[model samples]
Target: MNLAVIPARGGSKRIPGKNIREFAGKPLIAYSIEVAMRSGLFEKVIVSTDSQNIADVALQYGADVPFIRPVELADDYTGTRPVTNHAIEYCRQHFFEPQLCCCIYATAPFLQVDSLLEGYQELHRQQDKAFAFSVTSYAFPIQRSLRKINNGVEPVFPDNIAKRSQDLEETYHDAGQFYWGRSNDYLSSKKIFSDHSIPVVLPRHLVQDIDTEEDWLRAELMYQAYMRDHN
Candidate 1:
């Protein structure tokens, strides 16, 4: 069975009511719920949240709220793995246990159904890998990165200062959208971005981390652009 677990806690310190907060035209979580539903990959699309409001929105968007997340697990310090594990445990008891689990982030407005489907296909294609996640190449070479100290700037890797960008290998960063993995690996707390994980590369324009008011605005603009061109 395939399950899509959306971990949207209510206690968002950065953006108030972030999970249910309106984005463009609907709740932010709605985009994730909709995309997961539209992808048609998951047997069950479940939202694991500590907020009744989020649950209601999830249900309205055609997702199931099997359980309200525990308070301790809903805290700020709680990481993604534990929240995902909690959802997996709930499924084991009340519903169908998932063989493949995909954790979709509520704040990820840029999530595309194709990407989720690609992750699923890639996971099965590379049987040796434990996880397949959304990723995008870094805009710049990390080897040529700079660090600011006082009023001066220093090279992070001074040795690579003179290396050409084309000569340097490309590195990718997590797109922070979704992760598809074996349910057993998730239950065992396997690292989401470890060596066992495979990358599902997405275009940079379709990736953004919605952490602040500015990010939300930027995402809206990008999403609008996406709608005009792709939708």
Candidate 2:
């Protein structure tokens, strides 16, 4: 069975109470929870959070908070891999071992049900040896990326010094929206990317990370526009 895990901690330095903060009249995490549930790909949606308020809100929005996240995992320095590992082990101890796992973020409020399910279906259809993640085309050509010199001059990668944006190759970036992978693969690599990692393309507008107040406002606006267009 596939299990969806949403990892949210109590200590958020960028935006306090970000997980439980209201968005579109509901807590932000609710968006991810609802999308995962509506997708119908996963048999269960579990939220691992250190905050009681976050756990409560997740439960109210159709997510199961089976256990409170450990204090060590809640620290700011803790990387997602360990937190995911902890949650997976926790589930295994209580329930059956999950075959597949989708790590959904509480910050990605605009994750589409169709896109999510498609990502899962794509993973299975390709029978990919690695993981799958949702990503969007980069706004700019990464090949044209420039770095600032000590003298405040822009240094180009090719050193051609004059390259047109259109001439550069297009590349995609991880949208940080969500990722799906086999439980065994994740346990082995401790990462979502592998030789066969599948990048499911999504529109850039649909990908938003709410790490700050301004980001939250932008997400709200984008979400409203998205709703209107769909309607």
What TM-score, computed on C-alpha atoms, does each candidate reach? 0.97, 0.93
lDDT, candidate 2, 104-130, per-residue tens: 898888899888888888888888556
Off by over 4 Å in 1: none
Report the lDDT tens digits of candidate 1 across residue range 28-128.
99999999999989899999999998899899999999889999998889998898888888898888879999999998998988899899998899899
Highest-lDDT candidate: 1
- Candidate 2 ranges beyond 4 A from true positions: 158-161
Clashes of each: 0, 0
